[model samples]
Target: MYELTVVVTKVLGTCSSEVPMKPGDYLTVRNGALRIPEGGHICLYALQSLMPVLTTKERRIGEKHSDDWVWRVHHVQCPDPEGRVIFHIVRSGEKAEMPPYTPSEPCPQPQTDPSLADLRVIVEEVRGKCTSGMQPGDGFLLKSGRLYIPAGRHFCLYALQATLPLLPAKQRAPLDGDWLARDNHIICPDPAGNVVLRIERV
Candidate 1:
C-alpha cells in the first residue's frame, strides 16, 4: 500500500480548542496504521474531512492533466467554519506492508475488551439537499468492529466515508485532554449535501 502524509498547511481561523493547530502539525498513514507526532493531536473534524480522499491520494496518477478528481485536488478543509484548517495530502512515494495478522488467531471481541465501546453514528441534520435520501435520525451501529445498518434502511456512502476514520479512535479510551474525546460530530464533505452526523458511545 502507498504511504500518505497529511500536513496542516494553514489555519485561517483560531481553533476552537485550547491547543491551536499550527502549520507543522501532521499525521501519516502507512500501510493501514495511523501515526501522529509524540504528544501531538489532530482534530477529529479536520481528519474526518480528509478521510474521503486519503486512500485515492495514495495512488500514483499516470496522467498529470487527467480529469481524475484525486489528481486535481490536493487540499481539504476542516468542516469547522470558524477554524478553517487546511490539510494537504500527498503521497510520500513510499510503499509499506500492512501488519500481518494470523487468520487462525481469533480477533479480540469488543465485549471482551472492557475499554472498547460500541458506537452509534446517526444523522443529526441535513442542511442541504442529500442525494442519498438521508434524513435526521438515520443511523447505524458499530459493534465488534462491524457496521450494521438496519434492514431496509440505507446510509450514504459519502457520509459514511467521512466517519470511518474516526470510529476506531472513538472506540478506544481517549487520552487526557484529547480533542477527539470531546468531539462527537462529523460533517459530510459534500458542500451541497451538508449532512451532519453525531457519534455516541453506546
Candidate 2:
C-alpha cells in the first residue's frame, strides 16, 4: 500500500477546535494506521471529511493526469461551515509494510496499557437526517482498543471516523490545559446530517 500524508494547507475561517488548528499541521497513513505528532492534535471533523477518499488515495495508480479525478482532487475541506480547514493529500510514493504474520499465526493481542482508559462513544443528538439511521441513544464501547458495537445495532462509519483519532488521546490522562481533555464532543462532517457524538472515559 502507498503511504499517504495529509497536511493542513489552509484555514479559511476561525478553527473552532479547542486547540486551534493551523497550517503546517500534518498526519501520516501507513499500513492503514494513522500517525500524528506527539503533543499535536488534528481536528476530528476534518478527518471525517477525508475518510471517503483516503483509501483511494493510498493506491499506486497511474501517473498524475488532468483526466483522473483522483489525481486532480488533492484538497479536502472540513465540513465545519464556520471553520473550513483545508487538507492537502500527498501520495508519498513510499510503500507501507504489511504486518509480519502468516494466516496460521493468531492475531496479536490488543494493547492494554495501565494509563489508557476504556471509552464509550455515544450519539448525543441528531439535528438532521442521519443517513445510517443512528439515533441519540445508539452507541459503542472501546475497551482494550477493541470496538464493541451492541449486537443488532450499528454505528455509522463516517461518524465513527470523526471520533477515532481522539479516542487514544482521551484514553490517557490529559496534561495541564490539554485541549483533548476539555473537548469530548465530535460532530459528524456531514453538514446536513448534523450528528453529534460524545466521548466519555470509562
Candidate 3:
C-alpha cells in the first residue's frame, strides 16, 4: 500500500482530498490531525472516525471542517482482475500486507444499513481509562487521530482474527487465504484516553 496525506481546508467547507483514485481504488485512513482556529468549534460529525470508511463514489473523508484536518489516507490499487478493492485499518506499528485475491467464491455485497449486518459493533461507553483488558470479543476503532479501545479491557489479536468475519462486509478486511495473516487489527497506542466506536458499513 502507498502512504499519503491530504490537507482539508478548515473554512472552505466540505473539502475533498486531491488523491488521484478511481472507482475501485482502495483507501485506508491511518492517521489525521485537526487544526481548529482559536475560539472555533469542532463538531460531533467532524470528530467521527468512520466517515471515510463508509464513503464511496466521489469519496469524502469528513464533515465540513471548522479547522484544517490533515488525514493520512493510504492508497492501494485494486489488484483483482474483477475491478474490486478491499480496505483495511491496522495499528500504526503492525505489519502491512496486501490481502490475497481469492477467485473462488464471490465476495458478499455490502449492505446499505450497517446495523443490519453483524460486522460492526458500536462503542457505547468506556468503563475505565482507555482500558485494554477487554474480553475476547472487544476490538478498537481507529479514527479522530487516536486508536479508541475499551477503557478497562484487553482484546487479543487471535480473538480479533476470529471475529473479523462477524464484521459487516465493508468493515471486514478482505482476505483470500490465511485470513489471520491478512487481517489488520487496531489497538490504542495510549492507554489513558477513552472513546466510543460506531461500526461503519462497507
- Per-residue lDDT tens digits for candidate 3, residues 4-71, read 22222212222121221222222222222212222122121222332343222123436554442423
Residue-by-residue lDDT tens digits, candidate 1, 19-54: 456676666665433455443455656666777687
Candidate 3: segments with Cα more than 4 A from true spot? 1-75, 84-120, 128-190, 194-202
Per-prediction TM-score, please?
0.48, 0.49, 0.23
List the lowest-lDDT window of 10 residues for candidate 3.
35-44
Best by TM-score: 2
What range of 10 consecutive residues in model 2 has the weakest lDDT sum? 98-107
Give every collision pair in model 2. none
lDDT of 2: 0.71
Which residues of candidate 1, in runs, are more than 4 Å off? 1-110
